[model samples]
Target chain A: MSTEVAIVGIGMHEFGRTDGVSGMDQGVVAVRRACADAGVNWEDIQFAFGGSMAAGAADTMVSLLGLTGLQFINVANGCATGGSALFSAYNTIRSGVFDLGIAIGFDKHERGAFRVNTKGGGLGDWYGASGLALTTQFFGMKINRYMHEYGITQSTLAKVSEKAFRNGSMNPMAWRRKPISEEEVINSPMLSYPLTQYMFCSPGEGGVALILARADKAHLYTDKPIYLRAAVVRSRRFGSFEVLAPSIALEHNAGPTVDASKAAFEMAGMGPKDMDLAQLQDTESGAEVMHMAENGFCEHGEQEFMIQAGDTEIGGKFPVNTDGGCLANGEPVGASGLRQVYENVLQLRGQAGARQVPNDPKTAYTHVYGAPGISGVTILSR
Target chain B: MSQVPVTEGVFTWPSDSPQLIGSRCVACGNHMFPVQQGCPKCTAAETEEVLLGRRGTLWTWTVQGFPPKAPPYAGNVDPKTFEAFGVGYVELPGQLKVESRLTEADPEKLRIGMEMELVIVPLSKDSDGNEIVTFAFAPVA
Candidate 1:
């Protein structure tokens, strides 16, 4: 087996409300679809890594998928669960212990704002009882400060969501398919100051699975294997602004997304300019705007200009979120990160139909940022 | 009704001037609120409890426009009676910014870098009709 790992197959369960369908059942469908795509069977998967934050234990899926006794570790990294699972599977293959493995993520969440488990999140009961535990508040405050320091306008935030829905209209699996105008997004009911209801992605259900194979054997599985160039996860540094923090250090510093993105690019021997397209986390419109700079796609304030110029549009200089990102797809914590990777894989393979980025992109990048200040970044090449 | 702090040891109670209880890292001089054990910055085990400054500037803020869920949120859940509250981080000079509820809920009343002072306010009431109080920051008039 070669040291390099490649994704030979990919599959997904439609991202949205699926009444009466279990989250684990979605994962089983995705796994089966991926197996069929790669012309492999369940027993061919030597090892696996998967996770579902709100759903049942990932390892228990074996009861339905056949208990092959393969080592399947459950990962719980909040919103970075999918990326963490993919990272683990990549390393498992790179370590030469397994030639084939699967990384799967699925989740079903209650409809409404995600209730923070104060005690589980390392916070006290008073922290939540005092009504200071909402993640939307954190996003609003952080972006409010960012807009103040960076001169970004509320219109820019609206534009980002407008673009998300526009792209989502073209994605078959996206939850929100109708195009929303910038004016509509800005005029929507204010969930938080400067953030309208349209700007935030709700918690929902979905599942994604990818089959990995050693690079040397990748050709045997499929001719369109997407090589996994890099996969890295990073936690927040001391002074970075993170979700659910009761306090912040006076000395501000770079966030985890910046760290993870830099490390992923370095590992791939490429730079942001080398990427033909990218999929940055857009849990909220502000997150997409801030993460553009955090991922080194452009400087801190350049998004104001790039956004206005439509530089991030599907046909623009650098396409982003061709699969509508979390904003349009809604975030199923465990599946959100892998959804980014799945989009990049589809874009790189030139299978992204209407939302396909121009120029037959050869390299793609993805970043996912989540609560308690952790980020995951991945680089893929066709 | 008798007044009681929502949680003990978070801040000095029953005093006219109450300061938040935080820990200062002896190794790196880093400060954190609500009293954590180790230094998150320098990872030093040695630290000392210190009272944070009462006055600070609003670092950033937003409004909790909707009523949050119960259990974790002890505040009023009645959408009609639930008043919107300002949530923000107040930057204490040379120390750290503590996240707190702002007395002023109007967006026009709050601004980044505005001076704010800590004050005790009623968060809710317990089963016995005792008022549960929590610390918050108010814009200095």
Candidate 2:
């Protein structure tokens, strides 16, 4: 039987802009802080797996992290980069080859909507020329169809953002920490139909790192080890509606998030109800609403009532995005997934001071979805 | 006044009623737009080119409220002059849902499951002063 892995230390650079600091430098800071938290030396880490989208090579950090000459792999799986890095580190320790390692992710993106190059994104010139390559349009179109089908109201959408900012106000690391009223959110500039400016998460900069060790030896690093129950990544299946696609087949199919969520629950031997809290991708307000259902937390059209009932609030039945999530953190792409993991670790260990949930949470779940249709889900427990 | 297609094989040109070009799998019957070599559903290698239907229903839509960045974006840059455009997926019966621009820019004017017909509209002008045309879907009267 394969051995289990446990996260002994977690650290993060505040999720937002840091003008002068390079992305790689932020990563180094995160790694150092994680080492300090785990009470382990940099020389103790046996291997490393890291990723960054627009930042420099992750392996180059060894110049400052010390020339340990350990095996380091760079992952670039779009928005799932952090989750992919953690998944690799988990499997490595489970294979019994390495006793300890670290997974890191960081990115610094330019202002405004993420630009998709026609040739690089595998899209034809006509696609960009006609303005069909924008990611915001996809989000708006998707939520528009969903609202029509499920009877979700505009107020529900605003509520999701309101909760994000409210929770963000309690968390120091969040970029958008000021709470905006629902009316203000609705009255905000409409970037896409039905989605206001406040509803969207901007592209920003930050870094996060987590140190993992074999479950048997986890006690050597920290007293409270957060066990990693499962880490799974999945890609889009046939006929699924995804970004950058010019056409979709008539046959409908579930998106990648469903497959990844199911596999994660099965692997962890737990259900959605068992999760004390969750951190879901909130690229925009609609994403969180749809992802909640897609991850099997609720059925389609249930988010409308769930948001109204305040079930996803910090004091509610099921707290989500307790660290403000991507909506408040301002997604740094590479660091976004690991930021979720970091927040879960803090919450599971009861270290989240201001943003702590009502109950002492033992189990946590995280899900992230991004371009080209890929999703990563992870389950953790104290 | 000279006019040219933005890209060939996307949609037929110089016709009163134009249809989009797509690929259909010979083995599994999967359809894809702008033509491709293989099937994404059944992994079938053999496929045939076919002309898609002219009329379809709006599957979903949204309005672009601001101008996109340049390099990839080849549209009007001035924010004050940039016109918000409607983008949507038009599902042709028994074929596939093609993502395209809608002639209508007003979100209030568009609705789900509305009947739409294909039209070729001028997107922009090339360096040679030729009108570059592309496919779009318009609400049918």
Candidate 3:
């Protein structure tokens, strides 16, 4: 029995380098903007949920925003940090304990590739130094395996990044907007054997905030409120073969995306056919390629053909990553999930100037998955 | 010549054949590498330490053309000495898949389902100059 909740307001900080700026400041800025968008005040927020990989607890807003005496929680769910925070807030608000809540995600991460701490938690020194600890290796190995098993070619792989950049070129807030060609993507200095440097998103800094209100009171905040039809976070089961798993079970089981997406679709009372737009995780182009199938948008071995046919463009049959995605915006970890939600909101609101999906989107889906085998999905409907 | 593992209690060395150390659940017979407190699958508290077989199939691999960030990586090799290497998951027979550095760095030579054998290789040296070694999989000679 899930109660209804509506996202009345959303805001985002520019996705790019934020040198010498603290994540807290970025979060405050976004929060202020969201409150202004909702025609509400900071003091009116009864609860706040925040997500960040490197930043400290978002609960410190008591001193920063002068909005003290409220329940504030910090959530960390690997790359799905923001989605997790938003899900938690939605559930809490739907539970009748709170009427209005703010879910925020912000991060100021170091530039370059992502690396894991190889200490403790059953991992040893060999695991870290093995070079498999770097996420790029996972993407490369995954797509390499996919190609070998599926007969997908390098040219097929290049099409994903090419589309990402082309779509990104239209997004004002995206980090890399210049439309890139297939040759540039395929030849851009391979970071991993099958993955070029441009194929992956660099760890960057940014912030996003969303204000949610109980459904009955939603109209009091804004006339156009995006209903959070489904919010789910799931982890990988056995044989999932997710990043940071160190070992894979010999037996086969469903991956996080599959498990989470099915549950989300069921919870939302919607199917893949009902979704007019989507924002799937694209840690790398290879990830996006696999994710499209894993999320049930297409069948396995069918993505390469879709990429080649350009059916995933804005006006295509399945519009995806319409706001450049992580490839263009880069990843700010905590903020990435909410950033996807932000793009979907704008698309639904018909505010997306150049990247607007055709025929007006009535429903949208956003998902994220990363280290430790976690996936989060959020579905929005008008 | 003396060699030390980067992590103790992970693998057996100084023998004709080296094997990874793993945990086996007594209740469900599930195998897990690097050991675990209890079986995550079966939740069996009764577990036994077992030495894994050194033979496996190269399930998948990738080239690490760029250097990984440091800390646990222990910047032992100089930046000038950096050489790209292959890293991948090697599926043990009827057991589990363990991710390891591959002896071969050439992507053209690496193939899925290739027969792989485990070998101990030196990673870096500690302050006292003890050779720190880690496990890797290579195409069977």
DockQ of each: 0.89, 0.86, 0.73
Of 1 and 3, the candidate ranking higher by DockQ? 1
The pairs that clash in candidate 1 are none
Q: Which portions of model 2 show Cα errors greater than 4 Å?
A: none
Evaluated at residue A52, the lDDT of candidate 2 is: 95
Q: How does each model score on TM-score? A: 0.99, 0.99, 0.97
**Which ranges of candidate 1 are over 4 A from the true structure?**
none
Give a tens-digit lDDT track for model 3, residues B68-119.
Answer: 7766575344558888888889999978998888999998899899999999
Question: For candidate 3, what is the lDDT?
Answer: 0.86
Candidate 1 vs 3: which has more lDDT: 1
TM-score of 3: 0.97
Leading candidate by lDDT: 1
Q: What is the C-alpha lDDT of each candidate?
A: 0.93, 0.92, 0.86
In model 3, the runs with Cα more than 4 Å from the true position are A120-122, B75-77
Candidate 2's error at A301, in angstroms?
A: 0.8
Rank the models by DockQ, top first.
Answer: 1, 2, 3
Greater DockQ among 1 and 2 belongs to 1
The interface root mean square deviation of candidate 1 comes to: 0.6
lDDT by residue (A77-167, candidate 3, tens digit) is 7788898899999999889999999999988887788767656334666677655577788888888988887777888778888889999
